[model samples]
Target: MSEENQNQKAMPASLASVAAKHAQKQPGTNPLGTGLEARGVHAWFGTKHVLSDVTLDFAAGTVTALIGPSGCGKSTFIRTLNRMHEFIPTAALAGEVRLDGKDIYAPGTDVTKIRLKIGMVFQKPNPFPSMTIGENVLSGLKLAELKRSNTDDLLESCLVRAGLWNEVKDRLKEQGGSLSGGQQQRLCIARSLAVEPQVLLMDEPCSALDPGSTFRIEETIAELSQTMTIIIVTHNMQQAARVSDYTAFFLSNDGPGLMVETGPTSQIFSAPRDKRTEDYVTGRFG
Candidate 1:
């Protein structure tokens, strides 16, 4: 195969791997208002640089949207939080990411343990087809080997928390693949919630869902934020405005990605501090 074909194939596989990771549970939580913080982070993929001197804080109990055009390192920056970037053979980083006040990338840091506390939901709803809705919800618990008094009660509570219990309550054993796209996404969300994570990362979660389903997921996110901090990556500025408390815009320069502007979502949208942010938010450029 040609080099181009190899790259194309790798892209999808990489995306799938990313999707699978998002479907699973991750690290525990940081307190509200101090969920996660990245300071002076720089990363590179061999000679291709990405994420230069990026710094931001993700507060607990609030939704923070990381938005930017294609090629920008919005996804790359988030992947670093749970050490997902380590999967890339050429990836390298020079910075510190803190969960609460502890450095997540510090030596001896258990990457998997960090992920268990910081759960992730992908842009597409990729629930395990072989698993039932109930099985999907319990996937993380079983994987974590955590003991529980009443699995049924836990299932009911998590499903409800993801705004899915009432919808699929009677059909707990139904195959996760049998649900509508929106419900499946919520099922995925419920699955992430089952592990009792402290922070949730959603990457363009509604991009593939219908407007109604997207609305429901947004509603679920709003409710979930009361208990868990959420950081989302999205291209839809309107959705960012509607769901996020703060917004961080990324821009891809000649090398990789850099933060263009970040602040309260309302201010970023209505009154941005940077001209580039104003232009992007106003549809001037992607």
Candidate 2:
């Protein structure tokens, strides 16, 4: 057998109990109606306001696309969802970001724990080069201090869940960096899934890929939505229209960024309620 095939055969199985628990849950009803909710959200970087009173809700098992012109705070806003903004010394926020009806910023909440429930995929594919494909898929579990015997099954299951098993199954021992750009991105997605997050945040996941690779990522996103809530920040208007169930438009005039319009993808693309949304989506204005 080829080296790749041998590596693939050694992959671990999926965690049937874990996968089943996640799958058995009904789609979209997180007890909060929204998997993630940002209410009265206001953000600032030192003296500069970045996000102003932004409010949005991402339903579980659905794709919510955040679209806007450059520097419109779309990426910043999504980062805030996962508490990534806290790393910026100048950043500050006043609002309620809830996951499953629980306030994320509350005093008792552990940011680390919160992050475990909310996984993020960057605009770039950032697989750890030192790890093998199997290692990458099991990276999350390595830190949990749990008994790990079904390594092969878990690796296979997570890769399959990320829609990447068929492509990389043969090379589980190969360095994660060895894959094509698109496959690496899917590997990153698989890595995130290995953690079993309830919500996934993606920032321009396909912007760096060719059309074929982009299509593959989109397919993965669509399949992922069957069990995970996905929030995507993409500058590609057509991508948003093609993959998203709902769209949120952001714009910044002389003030901080705010949502100008948000609704079904069809309406946002076909008949936007706001002129700014129409302009941005129709190539009339930025």
Candidate 3:
């Protein structure tokens, strides 16, 4: 067989076109140092190592998708970025996750501030059960002890950005739990936005919702990327292609999860450098 066929050939036109959507999207004006960077990051849960030596950069005002199979540590990696991994009693991490040139794990660093600047949305929609819809959106400010001159405006702004303003605006006084699954996820997103985070980390943010909800969340992600950096972990390659500017693939050989490749979403989808990435993207294997 010729080299082209022996290895994975070019992507078919359909996927190429989907990827081409962001091919012309340029990086933000800020330097790399101004964005979030992971330098030789490693993670462990007591005796079990989950991630190894993952170093990636997420440019300012851009979206990056982490695509991999289950147990490859995609979720674990993102949790480390926001210091959420350490919340596990046995969890330990090494190396640096730097935001604006400072290590977030540095001595006496304000972990609460780091969490404030880097917001996280978990795998499921988790709006506070007791709070009203409007109250849920503005709860971050109260929990963080922040004072905003006009919470009415902030609530509307966050909901607008999350693409749920029109749907929930009339029912602001209703319980947050009254919303559907997808709407609840967006509400959680608005809750995160109330703090005005510089980076947002989403771990399977749409996995629990229906296709329509997933599409809406993707649109929200696209719009949000214009103002702040985003990192998402997804098992769905199509979602990665649709919402991300860059893509990173992680894999494991019965050991610690490792980043196999990283590049522009278009390039990663249409012409991945790593054979394993091609296999995974093409559905040949996980």
**Sort by TM-score, top down from the best:** 3, 1, 2
Give the lDDT of residue 21 in candidate 1. 31
* Candidate RMSDs in order: 11.5, 12.7, 2.2
Candidate 2 deviant stretches above 4 angstroms? 1-33, 143-149
Q: For candidate 2, lDDT tens digit of each residue in 1-286? A: 3853443333222211222222222435544246888998888999999989889988887888899998888998999998998889989999999998888999987788787789999999999998998898888777554456887887888898778899888889999999998889989999888878899999999999999999888888878887888899998877786677788999998789998888877656655667787667767777
Ten-residue segment with the worst summed lDDT in candidate 2? 12-21
Selected candidate, larger lDDT, 2 vs 3: 3
Q: Candidate 2 has what TM-score? A: 0.87
lDDT of 1: 0.82
Candidate 1 has its poorest 10 consecutive residues by lDDT at 18-27
CA lDDT of each prediction against the hidden true structure: 0.82, 0.81, 0.91
Highest-scoring model, lDDT? 3
TM accuracy, model 3? 0.95
Q: Which stretches of candidate 1 lie over 4 Å from their true place?
A: 1-33
Candidate 3, after superposition: displacement of residue 94 in Å? 0.5
Residue pairs with colliding backbones in model 3 are: none
